[model samples]
Target: MKGRFSHGGGAGALARGRLARYGADMTQSLPAFAQNARFDVCALGNAIVDVLAPCEPAFLEAKGLVPGSMQLVDETQSATLYDAMAAGVEASGGSAGNTVAGVGSFGGRAAYIGKVAKDTLGEVFSHDIRAVGVHFDTPVLEDGAGNGFGTGRCLINVTPDGQRTMCTFLGAANQLTTADVDAGVIGDSAIVYLEGYLFDPAPARAAFEAAAAAAHAAGRKVAITLSDSFVVHRWRAELLAFIESSADIVLANEGELHALFETEDFDHAAAHLGRIVEVAAVTRGAAGSVLFRGGERVEVAAYPVEKVVDTTGAGDQYAAGVLLGLSRGLSLAQAGALGSLAASEVIAHWGPRPMVGLKSLAVQHGLSL
Candidate 1:
């Protein structure tokens, strides 16, 4: 089995070996060596359970779900919607959850911070994330409303065009506070990654801000994801100021970038964006990714995929690959290439997370992972 995964014995060897023997069955567990090892990156964000269902584009119009945006719904509305929706896959997910999962998949040392409830969905969330080898330590609420006193769920409806529309019910997820962020954990990692989605809620936003402060105090870098275009539209001024003052690395897709800068032309957006964050990554779907830093532009082409299934966590996973590469001292160009490759693989599957042996896939694609 080692022979099957011993190509370079690099960052992803353990993940590769496990996947080579288990394939998609997920029975072969990643070794404890993978989790206990010191990390290059750690993430703090909402801990959410995802309820995913395939739906038509018309469903978006009918439900008034602005396609591709993650909307926050009240408890009553969330329950009503859940009861009305068809049966779907319940997966552990969140903006940063997906990113950390991707990091673990690629055999990187990754830990996550968020909150959930002590219920069925919380157990599922814990199992799924830990199974992929991410270190997650967050207290779950024992008695709460909605979803059996567990964490909130992000209802994801994937349209035929591979677009994912998300509706989030905060539940216990918003319970994450500044106290939940471990200063030791932030200091231990080479970089601390935060998801902008946390900003929508006050406690989670404070937690994110505190994490960033702690990471900088510890002389570690900070990375952030814009999360969604609509979220940017809602928090534009604040986000811009935050990016300028705090974020070392920032990620956003084309739509979110344009929305963030409130510009029609991407060129204008990119130029302005380059001035704010130390490094800015703009994903262009099939066209690839564009990276800007210190007035230099690097374009990484997308990996060719024969099939497209779901676009749920493409950006999150891509960011994972990029952060892992950057943390390991890879060049920006190489990092973006690795990001694009991982994203292509996820889109070829049905879920927001990877179903394939990502470590081996990265090795096959020439990444050290």
Candidate 2:
């Protein structure tokens, strides 16, 4: 509310590229503060280790892969791909998991609930997330990787254009159950963020419902992200009912929103979204984002970026910016502004996680970090 514009129906953007670069228009940077809640955002989703390496377009064609998307694969295919590619850099990643990591990068207190196995890659996943300041206490599946199957891994192939084709072996990550949803963590968090991809594993659906109920019972907020367009198509009715009943805030990219509401026209689908949920944020790549709340809707431009190396984690990072901003008591418009900033940073790099402390960057930009 300080410097953020609140005019309804596509008013001028409050934060532009120049202002974002200098943070001159921001009244203050987000501050690291003590809150009554234990965590800023409690993220509940799959836990995964991402293996990233460079490849050519022909590789994708030969392997029958879909560029710029994710899908499940069998253990044999996972092994073949891993063996054929160049050595990759392993990073901990998942849709909502990346968001909590980004929130932590912004110096926000965050917690994670997901499933992983007791194996090499699983340990790597745990250590990486914790190193970034996210609290994770999910119990590990013992002897889970006894054979070739182990922790879930998303094999990411980044072509020259910075697009990542992902093939996932869900493995132990899909084993998450409602019992994995920690009631205390959900109750202690200011908001519980759920990843729609969890629907891939039926038990994760129960986990999501449990987490949402816990957060609601504790009077906290519940947020959901339509993780992928395909995912929305697969569970449209179920997702809509869940959002209408339990979701306080909804996040989706333009394609996903269209798929969810069954219309290609963004505005037509967006109107449907605003009625079902209290608030919704729709991301439009370089076009920026639009936020809808009741009768009011505001547009926020995307932050300027010179390059887009890998879009693997852009949406998750955007959600990170928004959730952290909301938890820090920022206005809706200001929260979207922060989301744009985070998305811009992730697109400029190869990985989903930031290389620098985002909180410090916000301070440098003249925000109250």
Candidate 3:
């Protein structure tokens, strides 16, 4: 896969100048010996265990959850929700975690950074992620660690329509601080991807900045996902600065893009975003995605699925496709197409990560890997 990913346009000079402004030590716009780099992407975000179960709209109403949104809950709420939901399907999940795993599924090297407690759920999260071929180097929070929050978990209620409503207990995920960021790991990667949901805790917020700084110092591209619409409302200023100052690429859905720019008009927001960032990929549910790089726009239609069982990790999988493709030297348009293919896989199942290997699916879609 050497030289598989050369930015389609004149991104080398552009990325080099932006990276230099941030003080990355590089001789050229592109990193020297890209093939020799140890990893394709280093991802940082909450490390969470996802407990998903089928439910009804009445259950969501009873639990006071907003359909299709992620809401933070306490341990008590997590326990209660877990008890009330149907039989669960436990899986390792987090926005960027899923993306990194998706990268691994595409046969790309990937690394992840985030905090989890030294407990049962934490162990499960670690094992599941490692089993997927992603490297996890962040240390676990000990039992006596401050406040001793257990490993974080998201209780996802899946309705019949394949919509998922989440109630998350961040737990030790909130304990992430700047110290968890391994500068060496980030500096060795082609890109660093961050999840917007990590904004819940103050220290975790610092962790994001630290990773961004490390990635910039290495002249690696930085990518971020808006995560959810409400998160956009909560961290509008900071997220905007993150995109403008650090991110070379941004991932979002139609709603998140509109919310970030504070408007109902998507075309206006998409145009506004492209001006500020070098690359932007916006997913539009069944309609597919639009990839923006400087002034050029490329549209990739959504990959069709016979049945949409769960939309749990669709967006994350979409980001995974694009990031995986980009990190592997696929042009942005080619990467977006792969992203669409990955998204179609996740939504065809009950879990966030794909059940069938993504590499095989790519071949099935007639994409030459």
lDDT-based ranking: 3, 2, 1
* lDDT of candidate 2 over 48-128, digit per residue (tens): 888888899999998888887777888889989999887767889988889999999887789999888999889999999
Please give the RMSD to the true structure for each candidate, in Å: 7.7, 5.0, 6.3
- In order of appearance, the predictions have TM-scores of 0.88, 0.90, 0.91
Worst 10 residues of 1 by lDDT: 1-10
Global Cα lDDT for candidate 2: 0.81
Clashing pairs in 2: 23-365, 28-367, 28-368, 29-367, 29-368, 29-369, 30-368, 30-369
lDDT of 3 by residue, 89-153 (tens): 99999888988899889777899998999889889999989999999979899971247499999
Highest-scoring model, TM-score: 3
Screening candidate 3 with a backbone cut-off below 3 angstroms (N, C-alpha, C), the clashing residue pairs are 4-329, 5-329, 5-330
User: Which ranges in model 1 have alpha carbons more than 4 Å from their true place?
Assistant: 1-37, 145-149
- Give, for candidate 3, the lowest lDDT window spanning 10 residues: 14-23
Instruction: Give lDDT tens digits, candidate 1, residues 1-369.
Output: 000000112224332422122122421232221122266678988888888888888877988888877898977778887886777788888989999899888887798998888777778888999999988887667675455335788888888788888899878888888888888888777678999899898888999989988877776778899988888998999888888888888999998998887788998998888876767899999899998866668788898888788888899889988887666545567678779878998899777788886787877865654
Model 1 TM-score, 2 decimals: 0.88
Clash count, predicted structure 3: 3
